[model samples]
Target: MLTIDNVSLKGINRPRLSNVGLSLDSGKLIGLIGPNGAGKSSLLKAIAGVEAASGKLLWNRQSLSAMNDNERANTLSYMAQDDTPQWDLTIEDIIDIGLLKKRLSRSERQRRVETTSETLNLSEFTGHSIQRLSRGELQRVLLARALVSEPELLLCDEPTNALDIYHQLNVLQLLKKQSEQGRLVMMAIHDIPQAAEYCDELVLLDKGRLVCHGQPFEVLTKENLAATFGIHADWICNKRGVAWQPRPL
Candidate 1:
């Protein structure tokens, strides 16, 4: 289980996060939902142990701040929002960067690299330089990097921002499957309907403060929508999934 207690971070113009607390466990897909500067990224970084902040971030009852770089890397995988490597690294080579260097055996490392590539449908492009791939493809490769690490906790920022409709759905479905297999995943996302459908819980943030958190049906109310985002949306739900269709301008 992961426990967050009164976490806070200082930002450039204002405070990034303030007094945020939550508890999460395995086999759950959690969505961090907020506006552009809602401290979503900072919160993710703090949880991943990349950002220093007040309060406590604990995983399995252990303090995250106490872990070293290597220990944190093995415990959680973080995919930043602007995740693009400038080097002309091939898909497979880029993936190998996420492996736990000292822990995995040579064979185990190779297996993980291959498996992650295939899972993200990048096997055919293994040898292609990341610079040669389109934006959507590169995003997939980045996600592959996070998955290759096989960390117990996966934290991603705006993972669907670069994808087409099909790939967006594909990636979220894959994450759902990962959660079912008894791991934990937390993703920063803008799409409310999708988050409602796939996430076991939704955390709503507004200006560095947590407004509310609960199941999709409870958190995505019209009042919360207007309070968080200055717009109204029509709700849609069916066998396919839940979605909020914003009223046209």
Candidate 2:
């Protein structure tokens, strides 16, 4: 389990995240949702140790801060909002980098790279330079790199930002599978309907404060939605199930 206790981050004179706390268990997909300036990215950054914060973030009873760089990287894999590769490395080469510390043979490394590339439908572009790929293609390649490491905890911020609807569902389904296989998957998402469909738990934030944390139905109420987003939604349920259709503010 991942436990966040009384975590807070102050920016200049403003508080970006204040007294935030939440616990995430394996086999659960958590969705972090909020309006602009809600500090969703800040919270993920704090958990990934990319930013400093007060209080504690513990993984499986161990202090995250105490872990060395390699230890933390081995257990946690984070995918930033923008995953475009900086250099002109080939897709295969970038994927191979994910296996940095592994003592695999040449054949093993090649096989892993091939498998990951195929999983993300990057086989055709495996030999091409990452810089030559489209925005969505680059996103998938980066996600493949993260998956190749096989970390126990996966944290993604707006992973489906550049992908089309089909790829968006594909990525979310993959994350769901990971969580079901006893890995913790936490994602910051703007798509509320996708969150309702894929996430097992939801954490709603407003201006750096935690507004609600619980099941999807409980946290995605009409009142809560209005309060957080300042928009009215007509929530409906049919044979296909629950969905929220937004109305004019």
- lDDT per residue for candidate 1 within 19-132, as digits (tens), equals 999988888999999988998899998988777899999999999999888888888888888777989889988999998554878898889999999998889897999989
Q: Encode model 2's per-residue lDDT on 195-223: one tens digit a residue.
A: 98899999999989999999998999889
Worst 10 residues of 1 by lDDT: 240-249
Q: Tell me the spans in candidate 1 whose CA falls farther than 4 Å from its real position.
A: none
Residue pairs whose backbone atoms clash in candidate 1:
none
lDDT of each candidate versus the true structure: 0.89, 0.89
Maximum-lDDT candidate: 2
